[model samples]
Target: MQVTIHEQLVDVVLFIGARRRAAEAKGRHEEVKLWRYVWLLDDFVRVTGQVYRFEDSLRRELSAERPSISTHLGDHEGTLAQPVMDLLLETLDETPEPEQKQHVRVLIALVNFLAETGQLDEADGFVVNRWDYAPVAIAHFSNPEEAQAWMKSVAEPPSPVRILIGDEYFQFWYMREDNTRGMYRDYPIEPDLEWLTARGIPPETPSFATRVEAEAWLKSHPAHPYTFVAIAGEHYFAVHHPWLKRHSLHHVASTLEAWEERKRLVELDTDQETEDPSEGAGE
Candidate 1:
């Protein structure tokens, strides 16, 4: 009987040699299976947020296949223990030329793993409410300068999600826990950006910065309501869109705006413009 393996994990297993060693070292002992994980820095930080769950998933998978065996996980939080980090350090530490080349060759496996897991093209993030439009947030930066300030302020955090206007336009700066930088989205701009900017929604009275303050204001207004809550950093901003019929009304509105703009452009390009006969050069 052949053992089942997930394509995403194949390259990782090959490089780390943890799984290989376990199978070879205890070929005779039917009591344990071992696995070595190779995490990219960003992945390490993101997964670390849910570390307990990730660790459990791996252990569970190993146990299910080799039911009679126990599994193990390593505590390698800092960069020193990670494979790529170790590889870098090894190159710095005077690892043998042959072994170093071997490790470099093994990196091709990482590419295969990334492709299999859909990381190459990134995951398809669709609307939570499929019937409605996609999620959109217009983060106000008070002054234009504040845009720079806010972006700079949210510079470092673990897996900080970012909002990009378009793919090539502006890569909104975001950081990991250690303040490492990364881009959140890579969507197309020019045309696609209309999906996020449709009818505008203003803050509910714009009284306070926090959610609690907005909730208090809502009690007296009786009409103003919050559309979305952004729990990004130290503060959770409650965006109150008084014009929205429902909380998600903007989702559909935003989508319609993009569709309309694209359609209008198509019509303008296809229609033939009437030429003025005598007004060419002497008009």
Candidate 2:
């Protein structure tokens, strides 16, 4: 049976820690430092805090510009990364530093291997929170079909909505209880406009029956790299975005009279720019 990437990571970290302890006991100070360097490299890839100083020193010594590590890992499926890590584990003891005396060379070699094989961007093996771009899971599943089935089981149905594609941004408009309109502006995801146009779906005509149906159609057709948004019965829930589909619908309160109040409250709660409509909107 296969293990999740998280489990593999636990195993690797434990192995490194044990090796460090062994080196310390044998008075192999140089080997201990090397193992500690590898340990810190692992930490650096996970997060940049505290490790930044070590990374900065390594960066200078390497005398090469490296891409900044994203807060979240990228190889969501771990298909490419698992092999490299497994090989690294196999060779950890035999891999030796050069006469130049750099402790981070082992990690540098791993990085170079990734870059050479067009696998650098796929270094991470986890899902992430879209809102915060933070890693949330090791992997949804090794298999795409399994992951999709899991997602479908828990995904909140996409709210019925109409899209208003604008010059620079778009809006998701829905009818309110008072028959007035409510909209979320500049939603992160964009609809496949060309696909819609081909099917004669204007910003006004041919609203999606359901978000799920829309996604199915889009997935089958895939005219462009875009998605849709909609409002729920009373609340504007943040759903449909990748990584957010299976999670709880983020509650966003917006009403005609309460628009400004909601905006104020939201601004106070988070530094994120308010996405609701202007005060007295749809009045």
Candidate 3:
């Protein structure tokens, strides 16, 4: 069994897009929202606030160099980002300032719900991340089958969790009538992440269609450093890229392949120990 975890960068982009949308749709809580979840280094992440900060910081950091805010913040000036920007500014005035860190997380959760519901940019690194490098969005799965299942699900039922990291970042979210649902809670388990505890969900299994399909999807994401941790007799893999396949974390075969190679080294070492009289002579 294997699963892929999304990178922190994707969340960063989503946060900005959410803020831009929130600002544009002032007094309209239904448009887009911020999601709060603890991110790397245990830093509590508030989507809108962080985006605002990231934008300000980037602008300030590169003020002398004149780096466009669009480069780091987002494409707020042009047709691509103008609408989102408008919404963000409009909503910012009314949006509650986080009284505490926990409050921020709940807000970010609501923002993600909006993103899932098609109110904001469809889940992707480009529109959400604010990069025009390519029209790219990461669609990853721990197993290749899950990726295919997700693609099918996206076209059909539309799985609620879209590559967002579970556990610390996001938890069970409930969508309101207007599709506003950015709220956060500590996870007993998040979306599809049930295998977290030994007693919770079962271990990850390779359910993707084929290895070729898996490779193709993985090849699509920008960064592709994959790691899998075996839990409850199952393996969970996290991805840095967006285009992950169903069984991206099905690396039991990978582990076996490594072990097989290591056995050869052990045999060679034994042969050398037995045959090398010069080494023994010195001893």
Candidate 4:
């Protein structure tokens, strides 16, 4: 029942190739070009898997020879080959696992292909759904000290911590808190801003000004057993709690309101499950 990385790679390659073939059949030249690059990258990964320390040589080869190859192939638009080659090199530096690195390579190739073909929405979706390059977690801490300790442990960083509170996740390098940015999602039941306001958080507080500020806030609210989740980053860790779930932080928020809303939803679901069916039937 266990699927090997090679098998997964083959599946991805076949899926992309099938799409490319379909596009070719329909004369969808743009899509065909995109999928072709993805398919080629998959093949490249498989071929290069046997070679240890091939990345540098491969990068040099691409830099020296890809231009000529593209020119000879008449890829005037740079759509057919260059993007995938560039992405393969770029992703190589980001991941240590050879197989995961290949996955990233193909994912980025597909992203570039979709973007170039004007499928912006699809490209965005692919980034969110298909790409699993970053580490993710949902954490719970009993007290501010625990949260602070957890934060201190992960402070030696590179990538930003992406925290999702309600329907939005904010990205901030825990070391450089001034550069935080975020996006909102439209959930069926909106997060409770009033509850957050009561807790002294501004309704429009977009992000923490610094890691110090974030830690200070956590320290200040010692009694609240809050939910913390990391959506994307290289190093991720958290304190465990019974209520905390380890699922991907696919729907997250950085605000107290969002966390409260999620808690409320869980409570509501639990309450419904425990309700007496016989009493309801009489009503």
Candidate 5:
């Protein structure tokens, strides 16, 4: 027996539009403006349910004719707009079945868009007004507990530990503690010591059966932000140091090579200064 919010919105829209038409027929210019404002407010609520602020630049521009309506309706005494809004609130409180069903169709389309975009997490949170209108609708879920769990996961995700096997037939493992979880790609390429240095990973390391153990070890050393363990045949290398994890192994290798080249150039310059005693003596 309960009418939906969409039905109520449809009724309000039709009612306001009818009032506007009637005012137009009677040549009641002030009343026409009032009904037009009501129509705009009703449409805004039905669609977005956001507050209709008078000070909004776009809203102010759209409703620029309100001043003329206000002057004609003798709103200088402050008796016009508030009373109309109160009447609207009262009407919305007791929503009846809409004579026209267009608003219901609009509501359906909006709901479908929200659902398709995965934003329908809290349907009831969509309120009509800052005052007394009821929430638009309650989001229906088959398993509410499951839905809650999913929301929780979205809010705070578990950490991920990646195990990568390189082309040089070495196993490399790293753990990042954050929302990202699950294993990533298998990098079938060998990472040399220079690649490890560029990533700020230690040249030596220890082996762990699980990522949990590696995370614990990494966390224990706060000084070393990033740590990785690599196993090549019978040998294992464990290192604890700082590194940027988001870069690919190839990229890190190239970056480190460039850095090393710069360093060598600087060192060569320093060596040239030390070797040429005659240059400084003349100066």
Candidate 6:
């Protein structure tokens, strides 16, 4: 009887569980951490329904069908184990590199693990709800007033959940362990230019030193938000519009850092715009 790919996956999960347990029992903390974090096997187990059904029959089948794979996992000697999938595929000589890549991608999709930022995307975030403690979905509101109203009402007492608001700016309500609730908002302060940079604008790049100047530039160069840098107080901000024709002073930072960081942050949300046209054009 040929073992199906899904069955092979199930066997791998079973083998990983046994290996993880053996590592824990023997005080092999690093190996256990590898199985939990690097391979993300617990998430795999959960998604595969193995969390609820770690059947002895399946373990026995895994051991019998792929003894080499099983030995690699079950080895109590702890001779630097490899990821279960990698070991299984290598031993079977069945899945080619491309197919293995697809399988790995499928595995990741099944687990739904948040990779780096721990957020689904730019517009969505995860927070623990008071009642269930599972990740609750949160998103940005269109405007500040609605966000403020929601913060006071839906995000406060009697609500079973907390919400995180804003993309460039963030505001959220949280309850302390002591049961006190409070709101936290991160608002940008005025940036001071004198202490930050005696460095004048980059020779020719257009600099908007005031809101009126910035607004006028936005009106004329409707599509060129990334071309101009805005200077307010001591900081420089990357001026942008989430939508075309709408202007915003993105996160403010001290001169040099402001120029670099704000530009990078906005780039995450947008593609690179054309090079600043006035480049080399001396102010």
> RMSD to native for every prediction?
16.8, 18.9, 18.9, 20.0, 24.3, 20.0
> Residue by residue across 78-105, what tens digits does model 4's lDDT show?
3334545454455457558755555555
Instruction: Write candidate 6's Cα lDDT for 90-147 as tens digits.
Output: 4236445654433443333222322211222211211111121112223445666776
- Candidate 4 residue spans exceeding 4 A from truth: 1-144, 164-171, 174-283
Residue by residue across 1-283, what tens digits does model 1's lDDT show? Answer: 5322232334333544643364468672321221222333223323223222233344443333212211111232222223433443343245456543334333333323333333432211111122232232324233445555666665342222223231111234332324545443322332333432343433432445554554565455433222332222221223232222212112334444555776787688666354455555874
Q: Which parts of model 3 are misplaced by more than 4 Å?
A: 1-29, 32-80, 91-246, 250-283
lDDT (tens digit, per residue) of candidate 2 on 1-283 = 7543334445557767876897799998866765654554454344322122233444443464332232222442333333434334444435564421222243444344344445344333221122333222222243445534533453231112322221122232222223333334432322223233346423432235465644454444432123223333322222232232232122233322244555567688775455465756969
* Candidate 3, 1-283: lDDT as tens digits: 3211123335444554555465466754434332211121012122222332223333343223211223322322232233433343444444465322222233233333333333233223333343322111223334445544444433222213333232122221222223333323222212223233324433443334544544455455322243334534444443343333222333444434444565688799999888957766866
Per-residue lDDT of 1-283 in model 5, one digit per residue for the tens? 8554444556656767776787799998876775655454444333332211211222232233221112222322232334444444443344465433333233233333333333333222222222222111112223435434433454332211122222111121212223333332322222344555546654455556654454465455432212345323222233222221211122344434554675688799999888956766966
Per-residue error (Å), model 2, residue 33: 34
Lowest summed lDDT window (length 10), candidate 6: 122-131
lDDT of 5 at 232: 32
Whichever of 3 and 4 has more TM-score, that candidate is: 3
Off by over 4 Å in 5: 50-80, 86-283
Backbone clash count for every predicted candidate, in the order shown: 6, 1, 44, 6, 10, 6
Q: Is candidate 3 or candidate 5 better by lDDT?
A: 5
Clashing pairs in 4: 164-252, 164-253, 165-252, 165-253, 165-254, 166-253
TM-score of 4: 0.23
